[model samples]
Target: MSTRGKNHSEWDSISTLYHTVVGQLTIPIAAGLVDWVHETVPLNGPGANAMDNGCGTGIVCSLLKSNYPTLPVLATDFSSAMIDEVLRNAEESGWKHFQARVLDSRNLDSVETESVTHLFTTFMICLAPDPDQIVSEMHRVLQQNGILGLAVWARPNFGFFEAAWIEACHELDPTYEAPTLMDPEWIEPENVRRGLAKAGFKSVEIKAEQQSWDWENVNAVSTYFFDGHNPGNTKWHDSWTERGQSIDKVRPLFERKLEEAYGQSDGSLKGPVPFCLAIARK
Candidate 1:
């Protein structure tokens, strides 16, 4: 409960801004995850129960239902604000096949064991307090032969937003270990396969997708792209401040680096961001 409270607070603090920045990208990510799921799982059947864990603003749910109209989707997040936004979006979009719930991925007893037909997540696993526990819960919730689809940031091939964040975090503190690209470690096909196998899942497979973020304006790119993880806005605010550094101090360094890498843009900074999509069966 304490963990859930912290997750809820962290997400609630930036729910609006985070959603505005990431929601557009989520449509494609959700599509890619679903495509992987379809290829790995038999999703064509009727009355399939799918769970979208950590569904922020229900963007994944919206995209999933749009693609598969008959799937019974349980869209969940730990934050009430996120769930509220999801419910509102579902209502506005008239997504009757979807339902919103506030759920912590680390705890699956709230959801029946072996009840869900398919489990889906996007950009959520890394935020978890315990990635291994969350993955184990996902496996527990899944019915036999159920499918799992996940999208994570690829380390070496990730986008400028992440690259800049990495540089900024390091500049702030050379010894600081940056946040996990995905729970346990960075997202890799082989790593995901091994993790799933350890979780007692079978027939696990992973696919990689490289999605790019295009920036039109370079002036605001620093703030727009990295502010979510910016020292001032993130839970790491205290840690950054304790080290006598902050995103306020870190932005200029990031901007200079960007200029060096991409040159000055008139008003737009556009680049491709790559993401990895992993699919496994339980």
Candidate 2:
């Protein structure tokens, strides 16, 4: 399958569970990034129009609308279910002057050239089919001197549970290889800055920070990844199946390793995930 197709399928499968699972953990980080943008960028200027490209569960959208009540906001995602969640949350929050649409971030055809005043994408570029193309699209839609803010996972490592599962996969089948989820270069700050500059963005700035999450126990962490519901773990299981391997065979090993590395005296786990934040001007 093409990258776009695979991403859409994976994200669609997890849309319903995103808010209760991932969103519950990432929303605060999203809010903090939005707060940084609000402080650094002039968001309340007249004729300001903003976009949340690849707005997964609308955490950034909610923050944008709440912080800048009158700013017109457009939130787009490739998954219909994700857009549905955004709309549902918007209605519940009585948020006005906001629009949610199902659109590919790589090619934003609905938005006109040089129209948007600000663009924000949290945890979106890392999953984009073409990170460079997505950056170009953001540059295309932004007005002259418009601000662009983005958050992407840092490279060379996975989340705590993700690492545990990967280690188990390797131990179970010594020759097994992991799938490449996205372009590796996009995870590096220097590469991202270069891509933005090539896309016609200026004043690029990137910062790396660590974000931590706490889980009730190793079981909760394991359930979040291997319970046959998580899109990420679904891919892992499918890969194993294709290779004539059984993830079930490795489940116990994975759980034991996770408990040994992350388990606390109280049986809880706290995992730190790193992210890169970038800001630039069009």
Candidate 3:
């Protein structure tokens, strides 16, 4: 299978579980992009419209519905299951003027050239098998002076949570090594600038920002581990499976380490995910 095909299958298999697994990422991360869009060009402004490119579960669409209910919005993702979730959320939330399609970000052939007024992609850059292609596609789909809002996860994110995963894996198997989440260069603002500039975007601004989430308690955080739903947990499970190690072997250790990492005095778990927030003009 091609890279896009593999990603479609991987994300589709977990689509029903994805919304829950994203924890707070779906909203808080996308909120920064949406907020910036409002500052750049109000969704209700004359001739204004938006597209949540790679709209995982349509978090940005939900925010747009809340803040600018009448804005014509297009939500697209490679995973049809995710697009289905977007539609489900739309109907349940009484959204109007919303449309969604199964579209690959790398080649947005269906979206007309220089059409979208605002494009928002959250937490997707570094992970894209072809980030440059996606960036160029966003540039192509945007009207002149269109705003491209992007949010990408930076290094050392997930707080001590990642460290805890590593420690647990090592305890289970002495020589275990974790996969690199994504290329580190994409996390840097300079590289982001270069990529966007190469994609025909100028007048770009990028900032380092953070979004945080608090779980009920250590037990809840540990439970999030068992499902291995999120990428970190998925990696943790994959590492063990490849090593012939049972997930149960890592549970108690991961929980204890997790409490030590994210455990708050108030019996809650919290962490900061630092990200690169950028707004570019076409």
lDDT, residue 109, model 1: 57
CA-lDDT, candidates in order = 0.70, 0.80, 0.79
Q: Which model scores highest in TM-score?
A: 2
Residue pairs in candidate 2 whose N, alpha carbon or C atoms collide under 3 angstroms? none
Per-model TM against the reference: 0.84, 0.92, 0.90
Residue 242's C-alpha lDDT in candidate 3?
90
Residue-wise lDDT of candidate 2 within 1-282, one digit each (tens)? 001222354577678777787876678778777777777777898788889999888888888888888889998889877887788888888887888878888889988999998899988787667888888889999999889988888754346566777788888787887775556778888988888899999998888887887878877777777773765567667888898887678888888888877778998887788788888988
TM-score of model 3 vs. true structure: 0.90
Error of model 1, residue 171, in angstroms: 7.3
Q: Model 3, which residues run further than 4 Å from truth?
A: 1-8, 21-23, 156-160
Clashes of 2: 0
Candidate 3 structure quality by residue, lDDT tens digits, 1-282: 011222353567567766775736557767867887788777789999999998888788888989998888999888877888888888888888888888889998889999999899987777767888889899999999889999887773345467887798788688988777665657788888888899899898989877776788888777666764666557657867898887877888988887887788998888776778899999
Q: Which ten residues in a row have the lowest lDDT in candidate 1?
A: 1-10
Residue-wise lDDT of candidate 1 within 1-282, one digit each (tens)? 011233454677566766677666667778877876776666667558788898877767776778777778887788877787777777776776666667778886578999998888887775567878889999999988788888776653245655555576787678865443334463666776777788888876667666655555556676664555532235444555676776677777777766666653564555655666777777
